[model samples]
Target: MENYPKSINASSLNDWYNSEKEDPVLIDVREHSELEIACFPKEFLHIPISKVTSTYVEELFAGLFEREIVVACHAGIRSYNFCQWSLDNNIVSEIWNLEEGIDGWSRYIDPSIPRY
Candidate 1:
């Protein structure tokens, strides 16, 4: 099994997207304004960090039901914190955070995506 707190880089994430027959849930934890300025692949679900608390995260995650989840933020600090929280709360799910956020992705993988 892969590491529980595994962190994936942009290429790794793209490769996972390419190889997985059924895509996992891609979650962006950025704010709405940030999303308006830039967004990830259309397949992802956007859940702002303001709504990621234990009280409301379940609502955000409703219907996902044990599926693998990839959480991202500006530079992954938020996502990493969220992953740690999920583990602590025993909300067992395969969770990964993009290691460098969209900035790293744009720098190393796809320049077409803007950096904010």
Candidate 2:
């Protein structure tokens, strides 16, 4: 928990997604209702932060060890908490929290996504 998780802004994330050979795991940790309002254009693993149990972590770990992960929420708060919980629970060593979250994305990457 001492070592902070990496944070990626919408602009940087867009650049990385565009240039990187393999895509990172884009995770939308926002609730179902929140997603109905807006979401990332890219396909993502939509596991709400409330539902991320140990079983879910094990499943993610089993298959996603090789891929980078970026977690997002409405405004970056929940995603940050998720990142810290992941590290504190020893889920993964490298995980990123999307800074400012999808609100940032709506502002920077895709204006089409309506902000709540």
Candidate 3:
């Protein structure tokens, strides 16, 4: 598979969902306070950006090196940054950022969810 950190948009994500038969890793990188403002899929794993240091991030993803990871954040900036970092650091994982993030999600995708 191609390196995932470069970028991945929402529309492409829909295709990925359609094409991929298995459940990929979904990681939420937002802060706790931000999460209070908006929530993601219940299946998502919380590994806040605050804890994305060399130690913590490595520890958090310790056993999931081979998983396909989709990194999400409030607006997608942090998740994009993390994707780049992960790629640069030689962590072998696929990462996709939800373009527009929860804001876009609330605005265009699903309105039932509250927006911050």
Candidate 4:
């Protein structure tokens, strides 16, 4: 199985998501209110960072072990921590972090996504 990269830039991430292949799952860890300021693709899984727990993990994500996963947040910090935690806990073998988060996506890929 191919290992996920530690991080991926907004441009590369855009391309990856748009490709015809089986794309990675984009998990937005930002809180619900953050969506009012900026948003990502509709396909992204909405799992707020604050609510991530063992029960949540087992219930929602256990089936995704073999799938490519990418976590994102406002500025990448929370997602980075989550990715590390996932790895440590054996939740998933590998997960990619959005290097600059949705903020980077606004600056690099889509300017329409308002930055807050």
Give the candidate number with the greatest lDDT. 2
The C-alpha TM-scores of every prediction are: 0.85, 0.93, 0.81, 0.90
lDDT of 1 by residue, 1-116 (tens): 43356699988888877894667788888899988776775478887888777867777677777677888888889888777777676565557888988777777777887887
For each candidate, how many residue pairs have backbone atoms clashing (under 3 Å)? 0, 0, 0, 0
- Local accuracy by lDDT, each model: 0.77, 0.88, 0.74, 0.86
Q: How well does candidate 4 score on lDDT at residue 49? A: 88
* lDDT for each residue of candidate 3 in 36-61, tens digit (9 for 90 to 100): 87886447888888777777777778
Task: Give candidate 2 regions above 4 Å deviation.
Answer: none
* Ranking of predictions according to TM-score: 2, 4, 1, 3
Better of 3 and 4 by lDDT: 4
Per-candidate alpha-carbon RMSD to the true structure? 2.7, 1.3, 2.9, 2.8
> Residue 14 in model 3: shift from native, Å?
4.8
Model 4: how far is 81 from its true place, Å?
Answer: 0.4
Q: Across residues 1-116, which tens digit of lDDT does each residue of candidate 2 receive?
A: 38677999999999988994688899888999999999889889898987989778778768888889999999899999988888887788889999999999999889999999
| Model 1 lDDT at residue 20 | 45
Per-residue error at 32 for model 4, in Å?
Answer: 0.8
Candidate 4, residues 13-93: lDDT per residue as tens digits?
A: 888878897898889999999987899954888889899996787577877877889899999999998888777767887
C-alpha RMSD of candidate 3:
2.9
